[model samples]
Target: MKDAAFNQLTHARRYFEAKSAVYDENARGWYGRLTDALLSQALDLSVFSRLPDGFRFLDVGGGAGRWTERIATANPESSGVLLDVSPGMVRHAERRATRCGYAHRVRHINGDVDEAGELLAGMTFDLIINTHHLLGFFHSPDLVLGSIVPLLTDHGLMVSVLPSRWHAAFGDLSVGDAERARRSLSGLSWEAHEAPYGHLFTPGEVRMLHTSSKLTVDLLTGFPCLIYPDPPGVASPSAESAEDFLRDDTFFREVLAMETELLIDPDAGARGANLFVVASRVQPAEA
Candidate 1:
């Protein structure tokens, strides 16, 4: 399964680079019709309240620098690092950072999250973020998290976005669509197929992965917050439509937002497409 998944990511990266132009164009279209839905909600601000001014943030498995841009844009005073395992994607992110006016506040690094090397070694941040359904990159998220203790500043918050165990819809595939996507995913990049399709972590699983003496869950809930892709690999929407779609339809935006609220509420019945986790560093428990 690991090998299958890795090859999937490799394929996804190649596919994206081959079609980056079209992919970026179509994504702008989708977001044009749907950005409002994706942006309506806010993070539980408490996570940032305790964070000192001019906070520093590290985006784990962060590529295309999209999430880093968002965070930097939302918090202008913040400086950020866009870390990813893909050099090509890192370059894409660098371009995006320049375009988004976050070039000065951001740095891009290409490396695996599991490696505690010079790139990430001795670095600490007030905030950490991992988005686009990235929790599956590690076969053992707990251990992946264990290594983070030394890299987090006091009161640091780690926000990880992952696919919800219970979500609104699974594309309602007709006949073989689901199977087709499943098979197509096997040869895609891990970034493309990691979450929103390939692997789903339940709320329980979310709690478990980040459970540590170093931190405690500040928030864990389902959010249809992202109209992005299920398996975010080569299959994700293009940048153009991503911007275009959300801007085009109010009803489309409203419903996704309304649905997200329900998924986060206690009686949400099930879950949504993904879970948003905000965990804070905690002092170790007594021995």
Candidate 2:
């Protein structure tokens, strides 16, 4: 019999496979665009600017190569690998990379992160990107991190964006009462949203996880600190309508600027729907 972790991974792979055809279209709405902007800016400020020439990078659980493509395009001299458990996602990423002219710079692998040790044997990278709450799906995230950290060069970086419990408690989508939200958050277990399952973490939990893996946290930030839930009687927009809403550049830019400001405030920043972390592998001290 398959273990729970294996079963969850199988479900996740199937979920992403079914959604691969509509993934890009579904991800272009206002929220997705804003999140992408925030992530890109964070990468520029932290990782991309400091990368050495001919750097090697890896994208774990990179669906459709969205973030991988961005990194590849930004660093044309750098080569990288895109790994995902879903074959459909891997295929889409390969096709996109080819069309975007970065095909030669990136290799797509259809494999699981849990098996990184065997799947990526004898390979290491200068940087690794894991986002969209990739760690939360794993049965033992610590083991997953252990596998990944060894793949990084000394002082190498791993950038991740994960769901935050604080965000769910305080953001616009919250239940509007802190204690109640906390109670609700505590009861969550592998709930499915867009994917097969997800888990949320606190900022402190995230820090502890990295530190335990011998990685030092370099930066942590939360996005969209202020969230305004839709008013009563307002209907949620469909995918097409949401995309149309994002077409207004002026409105979009203004909202993003507001989020940028709020994201800097420690108290308010912790209320974002996601937490962005930049962690570096610690080098051993010279004897």
Candidate 3:
């Protein structure tokens, strides 16, 4: 890897390492619940449900093995490998695997995606899980994708959740920052949360990435489209208020139902805060 790229990865590693202790804390909130609902809905698809016994999986950029453990636990016969840049996260992932009593079925690698080719050399996975804006943090998403795509078997599938380019743009507009919004729409980095290396993507852009990697887009949609619903007589809801509203069991259920339905919208990819994709390696034509 180039020195410049390596330096960026170092920065990302430090950021995640600092958050590793509380990495899974986000899963405790209403948004976390909504995220779980949508991802669970996606995993229910036939492609994931019908995997053969003893299938191998890889969780790229999976911190603390939250989703990795979930998937591995659900498929008792399957084994998994989790690769992350932060050693702290990898340590937590190892502990989770042991606590879940599947230590033998899983392994953890403390390395960046830039070194994935060397680290995961000669191994192919039936399922590759990349979630939580993993692609956005990369300086060269294409390079990372290229490295990982080859590790996917011809019949393998990759499930990913990437930050939506338009979502970031809309977020800027919501704050009345027309300049930032314009930059976002023009494909400039929004520098989200002061992370300069972050790069969001449009649906079309993601599809093109798959095409270039010789992968087939099996499913693509947006998730959690209804993040903050307006309440009666209120035009703008603060984060606390939104959380309080979603805390009501009935409202939570209703919102989850609505978000699940939004997954089917053709334009959901463009409309959603995050883009959910399930793609597979292109199969060779039969003679």
TM-score against native, each model: 0.70, 0.85, 0.90
Q: Cα-based RMSD of the predictions, in order? A: 6.3, 3.9, 3.2
Q: Scored by CA lDDT, what does every candidate get?
A: 0.59, 0.74, 0.79
lDDT of 3 by residue, 1-287 (tens): 55534446777888888888666756557766777778888787635665667899999999888888888888899997999988999999999999998999898999888788899888889998897678777766766677788888778888888877888887777666788888787765775345544577899999998888888888889877878423324456555666677889999899888888877775778788778988988888999
lDDT of 1 by residue, 5-82 (tens): 243354434544554444362454443333323333535333556667799998877767766777788788989788
Question: If ranked by TM-score, best first, what sequence of candidates would result?
Answer: 3, 2, 1
lDDT of 3 at 230: 31
How many residue pairs clash in all the candidates, one count each?
55, 0, 0
Q: Model 2, clash count? A: 0
Tens-digit lDDT string for candidate 2 (56-101): 9999999889988899898889998999988889999999999999
Q: By TM-score, who's the top model here?
A: 3
